[model samples]
Target: MVRSLKNPKNAKRKSKGSKKEDGSSSSNSVPSMPAKVWQPGVDALEEGEELQCDPSAYNSLHAFHIGWPCLSFDVVRDSLGLVRTEFPHTIYCVTGTQANNAPNSIGIFKISNISGKRRELVPTKTSNADTDMESDSSDSDEDELDNEGPKAPVFQVRKVFHEGCVNRIRAMTQKPHICATWGDTGHVQIWDFASHLNALAEAESNISKDASTVSNQTPLVKFTGHKDEGYAIDWSALVPGRLVSGDCKNCIHLWEPSSDSTWNVDSKPFVGHTGSVEDLQWSPTEPYVFASCSVDKTIAIWDTRLGKSPAASIKAHSTDVNVISWNRLASCMLASGSDDGTFSIRDLRLLKEGDSVVAHFEYHKHPITSIEWSPHEASTLAVSSSDNQLTIWDLSLERDEEEEAEFKAKTQEEVHAPTDLPPQLLFVHQGQKDLKELHWHTQIPGMLISTAGDGFNILMPSNIETNLPPANATA
Candidate 1:
């Protein structure tokens, strides 16, 4: 279900040592290094001159240099609206396990904007030449922070925990301080990061330079039920401690946290799909409802009140539906991406037993790896295709009224018409290889992070300017 496809093509930090919760001495430091001198867009800045990013630049894609690369990752915004990026190590996984026999690690990076001055990142095109040159020198450069004014972008590595591949990570909505991680080992783990965040903050304020390693730090809770791995897990937004996970065995397990603070799993698995369950997403508004898509090319909506059978199921694609996302704005609106390089947006309210696709987008030439609805805008969502392009779609703009209405009116559309004119393809971002996931920053309306084989990208869509009215201006 969570497989990496082929090319498209597409930061350093410092550390210090301290004691961790597990009584292990480890290097505890957030990512910290002086900003690089290469102006984002070619010739955008002079030598020794700091970057003064335009306010509009925040609406476009800007790639940053995280010291390491990534395969899977998650972006979680804290209560203060600050964005934090968490992902397992890219090179460390291979070398650490093979060479040192060390457990895989997850790196926590906090993004900050210091804005007393008008410093911002310029829109830079990462050409092939620049990519080659920076590959060797960019990460290891230990340049000091130059006087770029107070508005420069800074990233701090809060902590790095010795763990596993961590194929997937999702932050809890009800308990923002907690997040869940799952991997190829078929283990699901819960982690409470409040104390770690605090410790990082204290170190930052005190400017601790001694590096520390967090070894054998255990998860808050761990559970295992699935015989096969490579599935998706989600925490219910409507119900605290309630979780639903899907696996390759076509089984869905429902879990609830008990009084003893441990998860309890149901003996009976929710079985319906003929193939592997690729993804599962819970209803933003309903506690008992959720939806799952599978390699069977079908998407099923399940209600916990019912037994293992799905309340509604539809043949969604010609190939495996690799991923599905629920529209945060419209609860019934759902989007699904398939291995056939196609994706569709469907209104579950108008769905029936047969093929129930509302609008089909076929721009992707490879498998669509990830699709996500924007938390700030109802009709806008972004999708990453294995073709190495991250395209943003806006359903509210320039849509054909007649076709949309006809598509919605039918209980089921037997044949999906090839989108004569594609839905408004708002923006296409480049410069990432094998892009796996894209997530809109919940606190920052226009910002979203993409994790891929090359590294991480913090991008602002081309149309983000529209979301930046005077009332919602951010730093």
Candidate 2:
């Protein structure tokens, strides 16, 4: 079930200094609105507190669930321009299922007409029944208003049969129609999504038709070299069709495009990690250079020109590093998330000097599920944790005593950040349950699509300061 997004709204700070009726000067203190701060793992809910996402916080928000729960998904890069800022947006995504007692199939979903504010489906019951009644009536009117826009968003899916449950899915950045899937049964398979993409594109023009078009069980290429199944896989953005897949058995295989639609999988797997490889990422600038994090509590940077071992290995975290994202805009910065609810940003340039972790955070209460740097903003990034919070962070923001003092004077002691809260924490979004992954839309500046056990949330917060000066911006 999708819960109402719970958010704390900061009251707008009004201009200081107003004249009193007596023409005498009075302390220009700003009034503070009620502060609803819910630190995901830190704060517990009151007796009957329900999350109500402030609708004004989002430019677009929508949620929908597929029949089966999916653990991994990817946003399909389309022919559409790299930048799109228009109403009623359309997005394409591919995901696979982990069903308990049904056939597993990979699906391509076309989500369209996503333009509307979130409306409360169920009114929260309060102690005062009259207030609750008024809230219920207000929600009814708002629902009608929500419908006044260009119709509610829709999902059109086309499926292709697969043998075993899919562990993770990654669409090629250059050729989105071709995607690779890791299977639970010790195998990696590549599938062409040309047919699926065509069908979804056609469905968009005529959304009235509703049917599941299931294709035959076939993959473009298949490999069963790994002894154990795993989840580490990545498609190189620097190289057109170069791919890498790492398994639980400390092995990584490289896939190079040999033809228009086929890839040459090297049988000699690259091996270094003594434990399971949890994640892999190709460098944004170097075609042969990539990074991998493993359960051994370390991250390894590998170069294909070198032999089987990592070019350089670092003791990256205290526990298993579950995820990592190499900054595309700022190629020197690398971000990593660990199983112990901690994430760190490292400056790759400092590796030769010594340990290179420049910034670290332990704000998440649970293991981080995903972390990604914003494609548009060099100093901004977003992280999702199993604690059900997708937090956006701006590394450029720092604690300034003067700014803090001014903020306190404006809020009039009504609202203040907890001492433990970091100044970089820009926004906290909570609504979904068991959130697994999130990615910033390459085309939209602040737009993001997140997948969770309940369903998915497509959100673009209105508060992402567009004018925040970027550093080393060349994305």
Candidate 3:
């Protein structure tokens, strides 16, 4: 069982905030002009109310309950037993109940509604529900006629690799296939889901004969140079064979894969961050150009064209820079978030000789953990902070008309034209705890996935709907 971290409310505070530069309060506060709250539906209830059925079983359960409903009961139940599988649309529960004279065998069931003739109850299906139903029915001929009828979903917990808690998870695609990266103390393994599914089938064929171990499993390619823990990793968008990784040693290393299926480390190391380099991103347009942010309160842009030193360095924040993202639409644009409770956007094309203060945001009060740009829209970006909030911004929309007109006039002669409207503050998603990562899907740009220290979540733009959620929804 994985233990939950102590809530931030229990943490000890260091000092009260000092006064601001303009004599205003330095402490963060909600606006005096209250904004309207959006209530999802009429079935909303306060924190501690118990519903008729398990909320986690249904993806649409949140459609009934708004905001953060109390999930202690759900967590307690999960702790007491085990969930066989948590899919995008359903949750499978496994229970071990006595059957014959021998030890009880495991049975699995889907925890969803079933309606037959007149009765309605939660439906239970086997793990192989699509294929093994006929075999299950033939094996239990005697019990089939016992009335009380078909049993309610019988939960049989399966042995899942990273079951209870997952600290971090990332996915990478190599041509027609995809692999997942999981953070663990053991050798970093990339599980090929397609191959693993086939292995499970082979294991099942030998189950009755008591020889079920599948020895054909492939191990993941591990990077072992980092003596300390590896904290962050980013795949090169331009070349999937190359990747960049950061470690707790305050060092960043570039890795390239060789034809012999081995990874080679580049001899030169990027070593300017006084503290650990927390984040790194490679520009999509400029493959050789990448950015790195660190606890040393600096953000540096490096061009592989330059042998060692960074091309440009900016004193980005008052504290550690935790996250950074490059705008896919705007080739010269980049954004970084920091522990100093601020995020800044810079234009690589414009930063020359004497120009300072590109564009900065001071909206977040706590450390910003992750920043992401919209894959479909260049001007849109989203950020997640330790304060448990995700804010979306449409950067193309300018707030000041006079300033926007002047900016347009100044850059109008260029080939590309700037939009007149100020970027829109799309929406704010709150109630998560200590969000650490945010990733927008490549195929569907509006959809995003985020993982926090508390739990994993998926966020879709309010206007969009998806038939099936992404596989890594609950990372």
- What lDDT does each candidate get? 0.63, 0.77, 0.48
> Each candidate's TM vs. the true structure?
0.72, 0.83, 0.56
Task: Tell me how far the alpha carbon of residue 45 in candidate 3 is from the true structure, in angstroms, after superposition.
Answer: 15
Cα lDDT for residue 164, candidate 1: 54
lDDT of 1: 0.63
Model 2 lDDT per residue over 305-355, tens place: 988899999899998888899999999999999888899999999999888
Clashes of 1: 23
- Compared with the true structure, what per-residue lDDT tens digits does model 1 show for residues 1-475? 4464221111111123323212344554533323321211222533323332222222323344443445556665455423222221111001011102445555555555422111122324455454333232112112233454122344455444635555677777766557777766787777777665555545433225322343456788776778777557788878888988888889998988888767788868899999988899999988899999999999999999988899988888889999999987788799999997899999887785454567889878788989999887888889998777788888877867796666555524243233443657766566577778878777656666787776666655334533443453222
RMSD versus native structure for model 1? 14.0
Prediction 3 TM-score vs. true: 0.56
Could you give candidate 3's per-residue lDDT for residues 1-475 as a string of tens digits? 1112321111111113432222355454522221123222222444422122111112211111111111111100111112122222222222112112222221112222111121112223324333233222111111232343333222112222331222233434342122323232422333334443233334422233222221333434654566554445666768765677766566777767678755677656777777777777888888787888877888878787686667888887888887788888787888888886688888877667544456788767777877888766777788877666677787655477686566556644332222421256554565456555566655433545454444434444432222333343322
lDDT of 3: 0.48
The candidate that achieves the highest TM-score relative to the unseen native structure: 2
Ten-residue region with minimum lDDT total, candidate 3: 71-80
Residue 154 displacement in candidate 3 (angstroms): 17
- Which predicted model would earn the best lDDT? 2
